[model samples]
Target: MNRFMQALGLSGNSGRGKAELGRMAGASLQETAALYPFALLAAVYVLGTSPLGLLLLAGGFHYAGTLAGDRQSRAGGSRLLLPALTAAAMAAGILAFGLRPAGAAGAAALLAAAVRGLITGRKRLWTGVQIPLPLWGIALSVILYVYIAGSNPPALTPHRTELYVLCMTNLFVLLLRWNTDQVRSASPSYEVDGQTASRIAAVNRRLTWLTLIPIVLIGAWQGFGPLLLRLARWLISLLQSSSIPAEPPKQEESLAAAELRHMAKEEIGGTPLWLTILGYTLLALLSAVIAAGVAVLLYKLLSKWLPERLRLWVRGLLQRFRRLRAIRRAPGEQAEYLDEVERIEGVPPKRWRRRRPDGKRQYAGDDPRQAYRQLIARAMKRGFVFRTSRTPSENGTELETGGRYTDYSPEEVRQLIARYNEDRYGRR
Candidate 1:
């Protein structure tokens, strides 16, 4: 493997590329997904149509940006794909809005998301905690608004209200699942057999059904059928507005006034419009509060019922998967993967043997096989020109003569290079 890579590494680099290494492929799809919900919430603050299209466009662009950034981290990453991707995103935004009847605000949001996602990918910005930065601000604003100003944001329209309810519901579920994942991580001391693991999984499955059943029932009861559903919907419509807009439309005013007069029997019962409006508003708010509380209570019960042994089973399964993948990969890919692992960890994963004094597994080694790789990564980071024509020994000599790696003596560096050459070619 070393012989093949070394031969390839010496193949001169102007147009010819060198062996790619040290790719950090950061940010999982979930963590990246977590960012966009907040961006959607930010758009929700303006409140006309739901920014569903904007949300979808931004998410695709963000994922592409991260993928492109990951590729560009390797050798030949920046060749042509990045500029093309940026141009594609911009063109997509233009066509989506210009050809379609999409709003101007939504189009502007799409372009902003594309640029932001690209910068995030190229710079590989660390999202603070596991979520994005904007979530923190949005959360803080909500907290301040509720506690200090003393009211919820004014009047979400019917569609906006429905989406807000569902999205918030899903967010709580994701948050609970996230917490379960942390608790599910296997601790070193605990262990479980196959039967016990299966039983633990059964408990989790039951708990999931336990939570989901009530939520389904609640949605069905409120939203199902025609007669009762229509009456429920009428009450919802009454809550659709409280204080009319200052410069109210004439047609809308007449319809609302007619509806209120007929429903409350304003002439016969002599009820004021504001009093009827308050009653409808209170009914909707109370129903929403009760539903949210019940959902939360169900989640709590499910979370408490989870067992620790499930985490051990999960860990065993993951380790088995990793071992299987290692066995299946082609030889060259496997060698490069191991080398890349060593580059990131300072020691290859395959080399962990013996326990340190602290009882942790020790992986301390100074293998001279790493000399060439260390020198190349160091030179690249320090802005030296990359040339693959030089052998490992020649590269070390150049670095030394040019006053790089000054901490090591010339003779020590030379000796390390010698061992690398011997180990590299001795079999041949």
Candidate 2:
């Protein structure tokens, strides 16, 4: 045993040992890949541009989803085509949108990998339903951007920005369904039979509900959005200001060119460069604070509404107010009485009981001393003190035999014992 323990705790760094570790890690990666073919797409999305980035995010979610499904079914296959096609389409979109060639190709390769997984049936990805992590990242981005940028200027662009934000939001919902930890943890409360599928389904259902929550919250925030905008403008006015001075147009400029330069100079004078920088910086900071606050609030709200099993997990980490729901029984008189008797006797239920003729056993339903009283009464009637045997016997116990104990007991004691026995074990 000592040798086994030592072996279990041993560490090694030899070439052969390192090789084995590498092999193990490689095998694990391959297994993860076959299951979640689009897992690789996530990295690409973070590095890709606009549509390409968003597409990869979606692909990652779909891939994660396929993994969840495969895990649910316990079937193994490389279900990669959907994600790959989705990724490829996204790359094509990036190219169409005028992103550089290298970026587009990189995206295309990622999509191809997903496609390959789809075509192959050798590997499968599995995790219970989860919202993709990237989708959450995007939502965080949107919240931050809107809070900082508002409806115009450097942050909010043409209508495309809104469309992109909406797309990211949708992806967030899908990701939550496939990957959110809150949803996964909350599942056990609704799952009675302890089946994984039921837990997974319940988690998915919760994600569907939660996915819309952030959107709704942001929309509500927007109803009061103008107030925040005014506040931001006021703060911007306090920062340092800068302006570019105009130069004399000596000889070569045309009428139109000079007029344009004059307008440019006026615009530059109106908003200082330093002020602009400070404004953007302040906006970014405020946006960050707001996003963090919203995230915390959302987490708290969901944590409260979460099923008990999931709440336990959430509280285990947060150490927040934990609500433990116990089975609520009716006001039970019997339970109270039993508790009192046990407190007096210091004896447990298992220590007292005799098998009845009907194949049932009786113990202290309320009072523990009642058994002794009944035994004494039976002994008095039967003319002898019944032996208290450790083993079962056919005849009535010493208490049941009666007689001897009648003379032994004082009159007062006998009367009290008799009264108690009659009131208890008697017909009532």
Q: Which stretches of candidate 1 lie over 4 Å from their true place?
A: 1-50, 70-76, 79-82, 99-108, 111-158, 183-209, 219-428
Q: List, residue by residue over 1-428, the lDDT tens digit for candidate 2.
A: 33432332212533333432332223223323232213223333333334335444444534443333333234443355365466555665465434766446545644554443342212332223222333454455555455435555442243333434444444443444334445446665533444564557566757666865665566545433564676567766654322334456668878989889889978875656667677777777887888887777566534545689977776665532211111133254432221111123355665544555553223334442564444444444656433322211212233234434433334334444454446554621
Per-model tally of clashing residue pairs: 0, 32
* lDDT score, candidate 1: 0.49
Where model 2 places Cα greater than 4 Å from the true spot, the runs are 1-127, 130-132, 143-156, 159-224, 227-428
Each candidate structure's TM-score, on Cα atoms with residue i matched to residue i, is 0.33, 0.30
lDDT of 2 at 330: 22
Score residue 201 of candidate 2 by CA lDDT: 57
